[model samples]
Target: MSARTFLRIAVSNTLVKNIARYVMMMLLALLLFGIILLATGKDPFQSYRDMFGATFGSAYGFSEVLVAMIPMLITALAVALPSRVGLINVGGEGQLYIGAAFATWGALTFKDQPAWVLLPLMALLGMIGGALWAFIPGYLKSIGLVNETITTLLMNSIAPKIVGFLIFGFWHSPMDTVKTENFVSAARLPTFFNTRVHLGFVIALVLLALFWIIMKYTRWGLEMRAIGGNPQAARRNGIPLKGYLIVIMCLGGAIAGLAGMSHVSGFYGVLILNFSMGLGFMGFLICWLAGGDPIGIFLMSFVVAIITTGGNFLQLTQGLPYAVINILLALALFVVLASPKFFEGKKA
Candidate 1:
């Protein structure tokens, strides 16, 4: 092809356009955050250098980023699946907590079982816990009794408290009142590369692949998409809209539960009081930014993981508050939200 034709072809490629948009949005977010740092009399250049250096410049640092990414990837999928059917599942937080709680219970109960049996049992318990918690809102939304968003959000607050109650009153370790005893080896997920990275990483990747495959090729996925695009039309054509909404929400919760299970079993090795630190909400933000695309979720989750993992470097080396990471993330999200306009302007 001629040079001009090649250039036009590259620009017209959807993947290329999306990549360009994402890169520009990221740069804009970084630039805005740098200005904020400069306004606060900090050396933004040094801070930026430190951020990348601490997270992406070392093998251990990169591994830690992967560690941070696992739960966010899974939880983001939790939100993404429901969004496919036009269901807003804001209960990932609750689902995660409940899942952890259930997994913890299994760990304690099956302490003497072999790894083969115990690990799967714990994972199942976690999914059941999360799915059960999600069902309340799903059922309500299906019946038109309450909006899923409101019920799920409200349940998020309640779920943690229930977990707290369980821990304080029943499951506390003998030494640590705020956490359970360490999980037995049988109950823990296996790790690889002598790092904290565990089976959960593989699970996340498989889930992402499955998500992509199902959405691209499955009849159920087609109907779900139709429902999302036009619920009334879908219903008229015989799609079971209410059933899909309920089932999909539960599936999302199950995935979020797996995230919780991996967290407690593979990462923490014990359920600590209030250990989540807004992972569900962070996943929600990631899902929103990625527009429910599996590939987008993976990439955006990594970016978020970098920001979160680098937060400690900023606090210790740059003397910036840890909360600075949240501000940076917020700026990135805002930039993404405004990116459609940016693209529109480019077209104009």
Candidate 2:
């Protein structure tokens, strides 16, 4: 092909188009958010510079960004997996909470165990806890008794309360009424190179890779994609739709539980009451923005993590409210929603 033709062909490629669309959405979102900043009498350019510089200026700042990203990466997968089968799992928060609770129980009960023994046991317990919590909603959905979205969303509210009760009544530390004691060295996820970034970052990346592989190559992936495309058609093909529904939802929960486990074990080293600051919801937003693409999930999660870390910097440096980040995120989401066709490549 001629050079010009090659360039046009490359630009027209599906992957290239999707990437370009995401870039456009982000630019548009930033522009809109900048206007909002201007309207509020803030220096938008300076604010942008400060945010990016604070996040990228030092190795420590960048490591913190990764620390923030790990949870969202895992949680976004929690939402993304169920989505592949036409299931909407909005309870990643609850799943994460229940998972952490389970891991905490294991960590306390087996506090003296060696790292090799305790870590895997805690991870298994965390997965089981999240899966069980997710199962209630999954079962309800499978039998057509209720929608997964509503059940999962309602459960998100319940999970934290249950954690709160456990903390106050059974797991509280001597120094705090609303948090558990710090976990032993065995229970804590190993950190990297003296930075806050933990093993969860590796775990999240592995799960994301696994997700891509399963969805792209496996028979189950094929079936799930069929179901998502047309449920009635998939059912007619003897795909065992109900079983997939229940299993996949539970699996998604298991992943979310891992996120919870990582947060406590790696990030906090203690279970605190209401520790999650809408992580599940944020994951949901990332999944929506990425439209269930693995690469998109990673990119969007990183973008969000940068924004989140920058929000902290903005508060200290520019005297802006941390809540401003939410407004930016909302604008981005709105832009994506309003221009769905752009991402969908509808015209092409």
Candidate 3:
């Protein structure tokens, strides 16, 4: 066979393999969901119908899903960026909490300030707070050979506690609630179309585009990819391994921090104890599902947002459990991880 013929055959085979893998993943998820429904004595098809209707049936539902996607997109980028440097950033949860805490503090401190002055300061402080939280693990890994995965995960637990302390102790409102005072009107994020969808959605999109450019075109991105692919080789090529690790981890934390800020300023308008609600872990899953691709992450974040939003609908309208959504996400991750053959075909 000619070289051209061989290339064509190889490409076709790879495409076939990817299609098979995706089909199998979907089938497995559906099967598992059906089994769960059977165990619960619920009609799987009816439950699915209600879920779809709730999330995508109305403009308000769709807008709420988009609102949820804003944070997921930013936080997923946090995980994706660090992954490119061969680092696992499980600290997004903690980073997000700390970021929001800082942003809230900034807002409360400068309550009399104008919107233009306070909002940017809140965002900057939030990023710094998240970066500092993430820096702890990065510093440990760089200096002491500590596992970042463990450190980052531990930080997640610590972060909410710190936020709780602030709300329950220092920043607690006089109304006897476990939440801080609402942000000043000037500090709240502006919305569009009189919907819950805020400027944060636009920011997430712009960041996604910027990240795509950095990952595809920049020398730093090339170096990060090289490091992720082969740390020893990257070091041999003089990629400044320690510095890159620290910087990338910080960058990831900063993005997550921005998510926390956006959540507070745009959605809640206040810092609360459970503001994060496992978004960091969800972001990690989104990164895995997207295989750390920026565009893939952006799309998958919306998919996840739909699942979560629809799952809530299922619970309220169909009497199905919300945990079903988590099961589906886990199944999808399991299928992807187990299908090494799918990835191998792509390499061919």
- Among the numbered candidates, top lDDT falls to 2
Angstrom error at residue 168, model 3: 0.6
Q: Give one digit per residue, the lDDT tens place, for model 1 in 1-348.
A: 489986885578776777888889889989999999999999989998999999889988899999999999999999999998888888899999999999999999979999999999999999999999999999999999999999999999999899999999999999988999999988999998888999999999999999988987899889988988888999999999889889998999999999999999999999999999899998898887788888788889998888888888999998877988898888888888876443232110
TM-score for every candidate vs. truth?
A: 0.93, 0.92, 0.88
Give the 10-residue window scoring lowest on summed lDDT in candidate 3.
339-348
lDDT per residue (tens digit) for residues 109-215 in model 3: 99999999998999999899999999989988877579999999998999999999989989988996689888889989998887799989998999889988897
Give the Cα error of residue 136 in candidate 2, in Å.
Answer: 0.9
Per-residue lDDT tens digits for candidate 2, residues 1-348, read: 479976885677886877788789888989999998999888999988988898999999999999999999999999999998889999999999999999999999999999999999999999999999999999999999999999999999999999999999999998999999999999999999999999999999999999999987899999999988888899999999999999999999999999999999999999999999899899988887777878778988988898889889878877888887888878877887787664452110
- State residue 63's C-alpha deviation in candidate 3, in Å: 1.5
How much does each candidate deviate from the true structure in C-alpha RMSD?
4.3, 3.7, 4.5
